[model samples]
Target: MTAALFLTSCSRKIIPGKPVLSSTRFTTDSLPLSEIDVPLRINLKPLYETANKNVQTIYGSPGWPNDFEVVNCDTRYMYRFKRGPLMITAHANTVNFNFTGSYIIAGAQRICTGTGSNRIPITPWTPTCTCGLNEGERRVNIGFKALLTLKDNYDVSAKLQRLEPRPLDKCTVCFWRQDITSTVMDQLKVQLDDTGNEISDSLNRLNLRSPFQQLWDMLNTSIPMFGMGYLQINPEKLRLSTLYAQNDTLNISVGISARPRISLTKTVGYRTVVPDISDFNQRKGFSIFVDAVMDYDSLSQLLTRELYHKRVDMDKTGKYIIIERCEIYGAGNEKLIIKIEFSGPDKGTMYLTGRPYFNRGKNQVEIKDIDYDIHTRDLLIKTAKWLFNRRIINTLNHYSTFNIAAYADTLLSKVNVQLNRQWQKSVSTAGAVNNLQVMAIYPLTENLVLRCNIRGELTVRIDAFDF
Candidate 1:
């Protein structure tokens, strides 16, 4: 419009003696600025290759990091029903990157007061988007209608390919069927331990406390499925909106607290696998499996039975299952090769460098790491002294009596207690102690819910490409 105005004004004030030569030249007079055409060089193959790689990274795989709490495990019986529980094993019926644990899987339910397959797109002309020229994005519409039932023998083996966790933009959820009985309904209520501590600490470290609290309040406001419990999670930059089970979609809304970008860099070496706890330039907080298991033994027993039944059934399908302490070694073979057990939506991994490598006195190398027995022995001896701290402390006190032999006999003989006594001490040399202030306060289980979400992944290669 401005260009048109300038051209119109020029035409109205045409000089009596001047004459327009060419229309192109005349149009140039009203142009905004001089234009430059720089020669361009682009390798389409590499450009498209990079784009494809990035797209695969986004859609091919998504998930949280895996952690196997090192402990021996054995399966036990929960309530040996005359047979096993009758349910649809995920092995038989599952989706790509799907996990098993009583999934109330939800699909696109064209939300509307009026609806039909003939739906409309609602992409609003959002005011301002800080999108860059090269910003890439995609949205996939996936849904299907079906009726699944649980038969008496739900034994089936299956493959579960894991996908990355995306809580913000995309809303993939497990919704309980409206027709489920109250008894079967309890299973849907059981939440996965997505490691709230990990999630919360990650949020806290990311300075997202306000938004995190807002989400908590929303979920706690009311139990979803109590009628039609809905868990709407929106994890996005700049803002977040979540609705657990509140009012109608109109009144129920969550405002996303503005957020920042996350970047990370790490260094690793032997002594400490992670030499620097340097915050990855990006927001750093991990999903800590904080579902406190107070009675370790009892909890272990419970999980054992659950896992045993699940896996026994999983094996029948012939897919290698990766569970805690499964002791998978001697790689190469796919059927028996599994690395991680459970992962959350956005699990993180801190890959430390260096390893438990043996250094044979300067140059003579070619040495294997310490044996597990040796490691356990060292730890047990230290643990023995720790379990009996009173005796150890009393002996150290008796050293003030100038009995070097007694101190050595009390501590050195059994434990490798590294000690360094300063010839003279400066009281203020060290920092203050804050034992009381450093409260390791655990939250009441009531405030926190235990969610047991699972992740599955199928590792495939980039076999072919298309333009």
Candidate 2:
């Protein structure tokens, strides 16, 4: 009778119920709203050169306007002006121009004879006398200021702040012995107005939308992350900061709102068109809430590689179990269900459940309160009491953890590669991730999601300015 009891106990087969656990809604209120500052640096030297070229073209050939009539009729003055190279400078969206040139004046002077009461004019005017003609052209300087602003439609508007003409050399009429430099400068102011208008118009016609659209297109796509997954920027809204000019370079910060994520597979979605420029809000750096995913299949393989075919002693008795295979999946109720198939004195399947939590000190995600499922406990109590020992439970719990710090490092490296690379000709990005730390963990039916906060600085560089 004792031998019969022993045989029955050894041959008893354990089968636990595999009841599906109800899913729980995992909500995280701390998931941050992402903000990325994409600093747009444009080479303003090209723009300045282009503006100067346009101005030169508008001025036309040298010795331009061989003669400009300032005062005609009885006491007339005709002026001729020549301009040198155009110099353009920009500071804080204000553009200034300096044109150094020379000028000459020639005109007839009025002649009167005798006293005022009985005066009679010898001639309506004396022979045309010139000033600064043979004595070399008199020096003059023209300066202008343009206040530039970004319009809502992305057009650049330049308002003429002030345009002044200053004559540096004297231009005295030979007979009149009067300096006409100020008078000549007054006549030249009209031409300066036209030049100012030309500049303003040129700036107003500048098309900034095309370049911004190109940047928008570049950012809207998915970027591949080696050994991790794909990153979708998922940009929502955008705003532009005021223009900053330094060392002949213009920098504009483009702030973006995004919901970024990492997926095990590439995600394809409808591409969004770039919207109009929004209100200006100055901000720096980036704060992103990124969902980093780990597929259950990958997690299972990682755990199985460490625990596969491992032998564990049940007790002092000769009885032992070898883990033939293991599978991990979400069992709902914020718990992870691990299924282990083993070969031992009793060959059967057992299930364990645990709540996963992040251990900040270890930088790991460890399973806590790990033990056999309720059904597994019931079956083990009846058939195989040896398998329900704490030693076995401890072994499973110890091996169920994953090092999140290492994963975060790998993820950052992969993401940085995509962030800091040349996107196309004359367009590139320079980015640095300050920190990417896991904030929360959620085990869903499909995969494990690690909600992370990524702080970084990103800048978009344009080597050439086409617009």
Candidate 3:
């Protein structure tokens, strides 16, 4: 795939080779809340399923026809998403003014004031929730990166070789010779079966074989041995969204809607991580659109302020969002669960890079208006964050690269690939072994090509190599 080459980058941060942002999101940094209330409930099951399945499909899966015959792909790969690469450093301080002694008494301060008195003093657990963070700063990079690689089964050459039929003890076609020559010569009769049915069976068998092979041949012949070229993967989209520029756009787009499939065990190199709230305190959304080189420190800075510096938006009250958990997948596959928190839902749509009139750059290509509720709007924002995550960061995971295959198979000439994803599984707090399937496909070309005749569901399950 095209991503095979030029794949030497890190797999951390929302979008590698991009900028970091800040926000004025209200959070208690100095004091870790005894009970940190995370209002967002993340359904990682779908995200995990989508990502894991994609990893299998990308490597050309094994054993199965979709899998490669030869072990050409690297199975020990994992798709990881990170928060930031830009570390913030800052110096802040606070001074305590004064303190007063306090005492606690129960039942109207009934004190015995005697040596044999069974009385105790108590005080309410009241402490001024205050902290003076002296002007201090350290490099707290909010970026995230992981080591991941995509793999599949065997090589195509091997699969074809294995599919070839070998000789059998009993030849199904031998009866044809007997039927054609039996009644003619004495020598031919010696080889014929005792029953005259061989003659009839031969005719019937021939007729059936003709249509079957003919159909097979027809389908195979229809399969363009050539036309399109090598395929490519956009790990950015998390789906294989193949590129085929046969028309005016002069660029390839997704070709199929079939969900990419993969096995669980084939996937290797997994490393899980939770967000660092302490570090996240720095990404204040949208302050002044600046570059990464400037103000790379200040872990206390909000992400909203950070984005403002990038010129993505200019908002007070730090109009921004924080995606608690999301699966990184392809462009078109929306089979992911996302959790997002925004100061105001209005700015939620802007978190993603699409048409301003409508969000998600996708349908906006046609529809002029987009609508959403507060919760749904936040969900969309979370999904956008996931789509933005890419595995183009880690170097070690960047093994042999691949390009989008030019040729596609099937009547619709559909193609499926794994573009971008971060997959993993876990027994949820509710004890559900959930699966996540995420991918993207470029479905339209000039004038909407091949809109009909396409449908299929991709299934994926993780397996342990040792098993």
Candidate 4:
């Protein structure tokens, strides 16, 4: 009876030794993958208007004066004239001036007195007389054109280069009352040139420190707050790429190079100079590899909830087995090792080993070719009738899949929603998930690391100036 029992337990006819697990493996890692590209568009009208307002505030007061003197001279006589109190009024498209002042004529005076000094009556003579004249208001309009350029410096500030003034119209009083409007106009031209120079100086000295500081604050404090689940962008640098003019708008392109990380704190600051990106080729899209780590504790909880203590019928003889505990570990070379302990009619432990790969079409991570470990298979073969259950192996194979693609899609949706909510008024972002695949799977100290390649396109629209 003992010999018969041994034969029955070791019989090949009773339990199959090798179970073929049909699955596919991808060997090519050089497949061309798409990338995520972010394009930003900015409008320049608001910046232009704001600059105009700033210029007006500095020079538009009524007390400021542009003083000039004109000499009315002829072969017979010469008279010195002075004009003062020139006020400036600035508009968006032009600057207007009003000069209304008392002009004093000096250098020649009449010496004839009213026939009373010392009873000596001098002949009443109309000598060359120096007189004070009140010149009425003179209005002049100076038109200008504004140009913008990206200045090369440590901070890379924006410069407004004001071109030469195109005088729209000018009117000046005739100081000599002898058709000398040309001479008076000449003096006014000199004064207008000085005023124009002042305007140019103000414009050239405009500092963009506040705007850039606000941008840094938004990027570091406001935008990253929506990275649900610790996802964030660690910006290493921001570089100016290109600046140009299109129609009435100024177009600027800035290149941002950053890394995506999982963080819980806000850490960033403003930098004047960024890394050299001159050789960084601008692409419409780019791809990134992200490591989504599942710690042992979380994996343990998930597996417990899904599979622990589950029972499976093993054979038709009313024998069944229950899983007492389950555990997962990373095997090198993109594989997972799952160890499961069984209870019920028999009590034993088994190990499952298989390679995990990304199913691009389904957007999920599936374990393929799962089978019993060598030691577990040997143990099962040794005690086939008492301890081995084929249903347990089938059950483990059926449930050994991770839905990574769905998780990625859900993550993308959450990020997009947050971006829209945060930047709806000033900026807009648009993108969608294109492809996701597993690149590698490795073991960390206490976690299973999964690296995946994600590809998509992101477009950013920035309203630089509000209407």
Candidate 5:
């Protein structure tokens, strides 16, 4: 059967004190995202490949220029010839940049354009036939750097800040027998500036909207299972912060504000957000409070299996006590009422009450302040002392103390095993539970509730599309 689950934090050390019984009620309060450091890496290989493909498709047409042009100053004439196709190359370095630094370079080659004319006339009276031509194209190297900034509009934009000119590669060309070398160099410089501007504009349009939207949808659904149960984080909204380039990879810290729920069944649908996105606090580290329910029927079955039909002897006069069955229920005021039926000369039911505490060192939830119910104690002392004996009281106390602890440990161990196993995988996220302690335990109408606080780290690897 499926059970309801809630979330809370863990205490660093176990508190040494006696359990106090009170009539106070408890409820879960809204929690903020833990102020913890989560590092996310983004690969640039795919981005480079996309850019190269787009450049080739857009510029590799039959009508596009494939050469450079040179012009004559005296005749105002231009000469053009075939050279090679314009090309763009991209290189990414993820290991050289700091967390806040930005320096990415892209190179363009064979970029030039000009009008052409012929100075020779066919006849003395005829004017020279003029036609445009481009030639002597070579690689003009340039450097470009941009800063990736996250805007409040939930988009990422690359701002080009610097462009540095580098020496051009050697080129083989036929000259027009004129002093036009300086003019040609100046024209090439202009081409480099124009080309660099176009590239920067294209890069600025790159945003992480699509990929992150997919990730948000995935997280809103069921996550990896923990034992038979799965964790579901129903996020109210997403918040982005601290985006910078580090070691060649883009590091983005995402803060998710969610009212997450956990369930054992798979039939539950998606949870909707009730609070506004502005209500979320943007911080680091992680803390969760969980309200775990223990059903009375399940507790009864477990106790009966462990203690039923087992006899405890008080004296050698055949005065032995045999447990028939056990039942547990809530007493409404932070108390668990346990009823035990015995088969002996006394042959009656007895009641006990207690408070619960989480033992961090032992990793157990022990029922403390255990004592006989006021009415039961008087009856056992006055009428059933011979058959029930005082030893039965001690035996009942011991059973209640350790049984709950064993149950809590078993549940926690299963969760820890699943989390640890995920951590060992190459492309999976894992969580470590530290300082887990019980905050409070109260009896509900249907089930006993144990509120707990757990503090820990959640590490997610971004490689191989792991979220």
Candidate 6:
């Protein structure tokens, strides 16, 4: 009960002229630049160690004049103060340091006789001391705060908020309790100021250009996609978000403007130098628009394997044709043309054209509005009217779809390889692609192009940066 069984007479060979589609160029529209955000976590332990190494632990010496103070008729003191290791912490943009140490003071009550113009010491300076000469030392606490800011040129500026010192024990002189902590702290101000300046200078000299430049160059390089093609990130402008400190780490987000594309052949693009840091913008995640171009030859093969020698029984009226071969190519006007050759009641070739659209629900590229070529339609209307059945069109529509999920998964793997790797000796990146979906499809002369959107998150880490 096939269509070919009912044919009584031999039908004339139907050879229709191939459709001459208008020559139309396929051009990709200029889309807005995509943003790729990468979070950066810089370790601050090395910086703290550098600061601790450079800051002096010992302040005043026990000798006089240089590290001693004398108040006429009050007291004369000489002290030696030693500080413990620095304990550093940070929050927001400020770094705080606390140092606890012990101090020893040796002094005596002094009596000055005579007028202000002619003051004289009446007694020799034999002094009884507290926490000196084989005695325990008095403990003290030293605290400092540094407010950090970053410049456009990648310079770090640290402003000293304040330096405070408090002594745990008070000295008693001449049977009266006396507090000499203020005098000791005042005497140590100059040394504390010098230490603060040293730390700030060291912080200012830290350079980030080397690491950033390496990252920029890596982004500009081409990455190969297995069995597909090459992908270029094509990064442009770069910006950074506000800085935050967590424990001993500095956290920030670095964003770049990029236009990603896929090509069959490797392409080398112009490399630009890393520019100055831009204003801070608060944003998360990354969004990239990718133009994934595929060759027509590959597409033709894929379609041919599914449709070749496929028998289509149109209406079961003995008017059926077996699909011999098929080829897919662009038909201009943003359309795809599938040329099908068959044999049954008539032996000839026919062309079906349709517009390709992305089916988001199914994650596929499906063809719609499929119909015969003008010449094929005319020839079929006269010789083989059974070919005009809607079942043929429906069958073609069912099998014409291209599953995009597999292709998207391949692309995601390729991209993630580049996103997560070590770019330099001290810099490394980690990223993951959460989603990649086809937004549009275009049939071009040489390639079938898919415009896809990819979403992901990336992080860059610098293990060691010179302080």
TM-scores for all predictions: 0.12, 0.78, 0.15, 0.61, 0.63, 0.70
Stretches of candidate 2 off by over 4 Å are: 1-19, 27-30, 56-85, 101-139, 167-180, 344-348, 374-389, 413-420
lDDT of 3 by residue, 87-204 (tens): 2111111101111111111111122222433333333322211111122111111111121111111000100000111111111112122221111222112221211122222212
A best-first ranking of the candidates according to their lDDT comes to 6, 2, 5, 4, 1, 3
Candidate 1 yields a Cα-based lDDT of 0.20
**Candidate 4 per-residue lDDT over residues 1-467, each given as its tens digit:** 01111232422222222222333352324323223345555544455554444443222112222322212222122323233333433332233333333222222212333443333323432343333334433333343443433344312232223223232223222323353344434544554455445545644565433343434444444234344354434444554545444543333444545554433334453444333333323456547565555665666566656787798886776876677777776533345667776666555556777766666666666667777766556656666554456576678667766676556676677655654543546655666556656766654444665666666666555555322
Q: Count clashing residue pairs in model 2.
A: 0
lDDT (10s digit) by residue, model 5, range 188-263: 4454444445545655566665445544564567654555355555666566554655443565556665555444
Alpha-carbon error at 367 in model 4, in Å? 1.9
RMSD for each of the candidates: 42.2, 6.0, 43.0, 10.3, 11.6, 7.1
Taking the tens digit of each residue's C-alpha lDDT, what string does model 6 give over 133-245? 45467677778888887777777778875467777765444312566567666766666676667767766676666567767877787777675688888887888777788
Once model 4 is optimally superposed onto the true structure by TM-score, how far is the C-alpha of residue 244 displaced, in angstroms?
Answer: 3.7
What are the lDDT figures for the candidates, one per model? 0.20, 0.76, 0.19, 0.48, 0.49, 0.76
What alpha-carbon RMSD in Å does predicted model 4 have with respect to the real structure? 10.3
Global CA lDDT of candidate 5, please? 0.49
| lDDT head-to-head 1 vs 5, winner | 5
Candidate 4's clash total is 4
Model 1 residue runs over 4 Å out of place are 1-249, 255-295, 299-372, 375-467
User: What residue runs in model 4 are displaced by over 4 Å at the alpha carbon?
Assistant: 1-37, 41-137, 151-174, 178-228, 235-239, 245-250, 261-287, 296-302, 316-318, 331-333, 346-350, 373-385, 423-467
For all candidates, what are the clash counts?
A: 30, 0, 138, 4, 24, 4
Candidate closest to the true structure, highest TM-score? 2
Worst 10 residues of 3 by lDDT: 154-163
